[model samples]
Target: MTERLTYYLLRGLFGLLARLPWVFVHGLCHVFAFLIGRIVGYRRAVIRANLSRSFPEKSLEELRQIERGFYLQFAYNFISTPKLLHQSPERITSEHFIMPDLTPLEEAAKSYDCVLLALGHYGNWELFSTGQLLLSTIGYSMDQVYRPLKNKALDRLFAEQRQRFGARLVAKDKIARHIVEYVRAQDGRHWLVAMITDQAPGIGHATYFTDFLHQPTAVLDGIERLGRKYHLPIFYFDIERRSPIQFVGRYVPLYDPKEGDLPNYTITERYARLMEANIQRDPAAWLWSHKRWKRPLEHYPNAVRSARLQALLDSAKDN
Candidate 1:
């Protein structure tokens, strides 16, 4: 009962806050960023280090600018969540979201039972999911794989918000079987299994170190492996923020299941390249505060190829 009341109170507060002017909301974010960035010195330092590592060619001033922009964007993303939660589909679509070419993904979905839709924390990821929901309403069933949040209350609220557009949220732990089942059940109708490929996988998961933003970074291999195992088509969804209120969705074909066997790393590398390109185009739009490189130095070093990644690759080669 207490939890329910708290949830409703939070929702009410968000709805009320959403009524504020856009400029006011953004101004609040700027102030929040300034304070939070100062208090969280370690996070700011991490972002700076990451920016430096990713863009060594960039001048110190340029990197600092990127870091500052990242904090501001991060703050805005947080502040705008409530507004997004309360926004209706009509309003969201009418606002600033445009899908230039969704046909390729649709066509591939028709042929393949399951599709591995790779996206990143670029632009408004929430908007991308909403867009996916809208696409599904036209005739597609999207099963989104999401990492579980530690806070149960927040997680429930997030789940509700994500499902507002009809996309099913499949928790990460249950994703493999849920995806297989969903694909088999859908049988040819068209089902998209969306996975954010940019997150760093937990320790001991199958990961590969690739050249991302000019740095050796470890990335998850689940999407590619699952795509191969299920013979699913792979598509990369690039979210471009045209304005604070609008975004453009661009689809790029990554792999066709019918094509010959492609290495998982190859597919992941291709997706990574696309994400890098997007981040390069608009550095601040991507999620920069995430501890993307969280693995310990002894585990996954900043060197060209970390020992773990090297061993994994070597083992694969031997096999």
Candidate 2:
């Protein structure tokens, strides 16, 4: 009963917030950022620790600026996400997420059977999920593999927002089978599969590790594995906030199995490098509060398969 009331309250708040102009909402988000970072100090330690470990060269003062900037963008993403559902397609594309150079992705769609997008938790990722609407008009269909949140109401809310632009949201466990069936069913129609791969792999998920942001990171190998099996080319996005309310993104396609000979985990390593570069560029748009390196390498079940990664993680820890 209490949880139900809380859900209703949140839903009502979203409705009210969604009605406000973007500028008004932006101001409110600044306040939200200040409260969370300065007064509330919500996960400040985690954010600091993440920033410090990731960029060991940054001085204390430099890290603080990044932290503040991160908090501001973080609040903007949080506050704006709920309200985004009410925005028109024009507002979404024009003012919110402005992706101008989709030509490369379009070409990939034309050439590939299925294009797998390796994504991360960066700058208005929820908003970018709506890109399917734009791509679909050009004959490309989009689907994403996502692990639902614990709260059912919130999960439903996210699913509705992300699926608004016609992107299919498949459960993580069922994603592989779903993609296989999708590729088989679509025939000539191209399926663009988006998988946010940077988050710490949950139980029974990690299969590869790499040096990401100067720490031993366990990366999900599913995207690369599926790409190799299905002959799909992998792509990643470079998302940067143009302003408090706006973002610009470009797709960085990693490998073309048909064009080149690349080994396994090449897609995975490429994504890690691309994401790290983006983080280095902005240093704040990426989610720093996430415990990205929580799971140690030794805990992984397939140590022999991942021995190289394990050694890297151990070496990072030693120095």
Candidate 3:
């Protein structure tokens, strides 16, 4: 009963907040940033550690600046995310979230039945859902893959907000099945699958270790495998925050098996490099509080690794 009441209270609070003007919400983000980053010091150690390790070449002062900026960006993403639930399609598709020249993606969709999107937890990633409505204008179906949250009520809330714009949410494990069904149905509609590829791979998931952000990082290889098997065209977004309430994005074609064959881990390596460049452009824009390197490379026995990555793993394991 208490948990249910808490969920309702949060739902109501978010609904009220969502109706507020962007300026007011922007102001609230400052307070939220201060409370979490300054007063409560929420995951300050983790954030600082992540920043320092990823940019070892930087001085203490530089890392500190990045750390502070990360907190503000994190706060903005969290507080403004719920606004998607109440905002109209016009409001969601406005200048606040710009997608400049989607010509490349559109042309690719014309040639293929499915396009895979590789996304990182950078910028206001939640706003990417606006693509369901925005891309639909061009006759494309959008689907996002998500791992279910532990809390049932919170998970339900997230589902409602995510699907509010017309995108279907598929369970991580069932995404392949969904894609297979979509393709076999021969509906003659273009489908876009968006996957957040930067997270540390979960247990039982295939992983590949590579030098990313100056460390041996583990990345999910599912995108590469699926794209190769199904000959799907893949793309990644280059997003830049224009203001506290706005972001401008460009879709860049990453890879397509239909073009030609590439070496093993080539697709994942390209994605890692692209994501690394994105984080370096605005260090604070990425999610620093996440324990990205928590799972040491040595944990996965079957993980694919290059010589340098393996050496790093061996050295860490010996220490």
Task: Indicate which candidate wins on lDDT.
Answer: 3
lDDT of 3 by residue, 102-138 (tens): 7877898777878889989988887888777778877
Which residue window of length 10 is worst by lDDT in model 1?
Answer: 300-309
Which tens-of-lDDT digit does each residue in 1-319 have in candidate 2? 7667767777787788888887888899999999999999989988998999888999999999999999998998879887886788888888888888888777886767578888788887888777876787778888888888898777877787789789889888887887788668857787888888888877777777777777767887778888888877878878877876688878887878776667667777888889889889888888998988888766975732334555765776799
Which pairs clash in the backbone of model 2? none
Task: Write candidate 1's Cα lDDT for 177-228 as tens digits.
Answer: 9777866785556677888988877777634686577555777778888888
Off by over 4 Å in 1: 1-6, 38-42, 186-188, 296-319
| Per-model lDDT | 0.75, 0.81, 0.83
RMSD of each: 4.7, 2.7, 2.6
Model 3 residue 285 CA deviation (Å) reads 1.1
Best by TM-score: 3
- Candidates ranked, most accurate by TM-score first: 3, 2, 1
Q: Estimated TM-score per prediction?
A: 0.87, 0.90, 0.92
Sorted by lDDT (best first), the order is: 3, 2, 1
lDDT, residue 79, model 3: 85
